[model samples]
Target: MVRKKGVYGIAIVALICFLLIVFCTKEPDTVRISHNFQAIEFEDVDVIGEDISIDKIIDTQRLRLERKFDVFKFVTNKTFNKLSMLSGGQPLRTIIVTTWRSGSTFLGDVLNSLPGNYYHYEPLLHYGIMQIRGPPHADTAIKTLKNLLNCDYTDLENYLTFGMSHIYLFTHNKRLWTQCEAYPQYCWNATFLNEFCRLFPFQSMKVVRVRLRLIEELLSDKRLNTKVILLVRDPRGTLQSRRHRDWCPGEPDCDRPDLLCADMVSDYSAAIKFNKMYSRRFRTLRYEDLSLSPYKVVQDLFDWIGINVHPEIKEFLDTHTTVNVGGVSSTYRDSKNVPFHWKNDLNYTEIQSIEATCEEAMKLWGYVKTKGPKLRDFNPLTSYTIK
Candidate 1:
């Protein structure tokens, strides 16, 4: 009886070892790939030789598209608990709360430039598969975002499931999206994302969907070690930029000031409340101020958030804020003059419409009206005088 029991115990150990090996080497589920999934692509280049001029993008799109895909298997759960990560003394949770065309993307690129920071660009891009439709979806945005910032990818399975039709969604985190760039299969695998997300020390995500009031939960959540940055822009400039994206909405929402200012007014009120409560955890940035004085404002911003300005951000600011400008969605721009670009484009009539609708926001947020004669000359767009 004793010999038989020993043989049975040895058999059980062998079975357990075999199971572990099989689980480790199993092929990724192919059903994870969607038949209707749209292809996601980003423009990039490869260096062919020692010289920069000879560099060219290795054209792999054809080959990449033609190949069959199997999800990339991910292999680690090396993440520490949020308490442990934060108590060890430095993984700060920073979130950018702003709307599109408000220079949020530009600011996002700036913040993500720092090494050791893992950036989740527009994590709320999954609402209805693009952008958040309205406040009714606030709960969804809030829950999903908190999960993302916490490095919990369980809730993000669908968002990362098919990669992203919106390239900027992940491309902003160059360190991350590269893994999915070649074979989107990697992005579809939640296990891969779960492990990838935990590898970063500083986890940050910028969101345009939810309002400032909605962000209060995150600020109050101690487990997150959270900090919020509210970035507001002059309504005129935001509307003007939205006009460039003619295909996008131009109504009581995106391009229109009525709903836009309503949202801002509510957000500003929350900012005031949050400032009094979580002073260190909450801060606001005006796009006009940052654009007008990139270096000073950014450095002050970094200091406020207890982070040193990365050298990469300086190079980014130099490259993007100068003559190397791009289109409506691109982050590249003449940062100093961008805030006033709308001044040259918007006529008195258009300005009147926005200013009238956003009167409360403009006054409360310190954006001076087009009263002075030099309005056309790009005079001071902001003021210390808050009504």
Candidate 2:
């Protein structure tokens, strides 16, 4: 009985010492920004157009917990954020500035395929929807996009439910809740979801619905810490693809030279203008170049984002790259056939109209006019060479 009593007393004493050490340790009370960009603050006005209360849309519990954690860690550990960067686990927010039928789907797929990465697809779809009280302004879209990059869906929840407002943060094919049902392992674990939320290397958004005029406003905001990949396609190809798919229902006839082609030119001009101002954060990619040399192209893109291609992403591309040639709904074709499909599919007048409308962009992007049914051979076997 005496021995038992002594052992119990020792156990209590050891537990006390452990508790004291944990509470007394003094860590530096400063959390440094992991990256070199400035943090941005959102505007006071409600970004969502709905009349509902903000709390209804926001997951207040999650936001509060995140803010509290950020404050607590900032006060307790100076080295915490630095360690995240050093370990190559720092959050990287990326926005792929693109338009419809411009190969953004494939690129978004590649980005989303990367483990620990998130992809938001066309979050600006709410702009055209009438069910929403008002069209989403550039400022509102930019604000919502930035919030999503940080995993804050506060103002975006209501917008995602209405008319043409189907913004996809993960996959467009599957609803947000059904994502886990389709891919179980990729689903968030309730226990570690918070930790998982904080550990991603990339949070990407691909926008095709927003106006090109918004590029400056969106990219100029340094708080976003976003790299904009201005993706362009040969206007001839873009028009042909759009017409074939008829994806944008509200737009005028795509075949009308003034419609799709003019929009393409405007977007390209915006990209060019912004590239001049924010040369460091802006990059322009052409579908022709990407199709001909996807491996080299994405390698450069991945380098711009400061990450090597994830092996699984590479493998996924290897299989999917050749599966669909024209668009998501189109039939499977040789991967090399993608860039040259315009050669066979588009006739002389159609090509001429697109070329005339997109003359400046074609020249700017180095898309030389070719006049042959014969396609230059491109070997898909050389697809993604991992260095």
Best by TM-score: 1
- Candidate 1: minimum summed lDDT over ten consecutive residues — where? 66-75
Question: Every model's Cα RMSD, please?
Answer: 15.9, 13.4
Worst 10 residues of 2 by lDDT: 35-44
What digit string (tens of lDDT, one per residue) describes model 2 on residues 306-345?
A: 6656665566557665665444553233455675667667
Compared with the true structure, what per-residue lDDT tens digits does model 1 show for residues 276-340? Answer: 99987888889988887898998887777666676666777777776644567767777788777
User: What residue pairs clash in candidate 1, if any at all?
Assistant: none
Give the top-scoring candidate (lDDT). 1
Model 2: how far residue 142 lies from native, Å:
2.4
Candidate 2, residue 205: lDDT: 78
Each prediction's TM-score versus the true structure: 0.73, 0.63
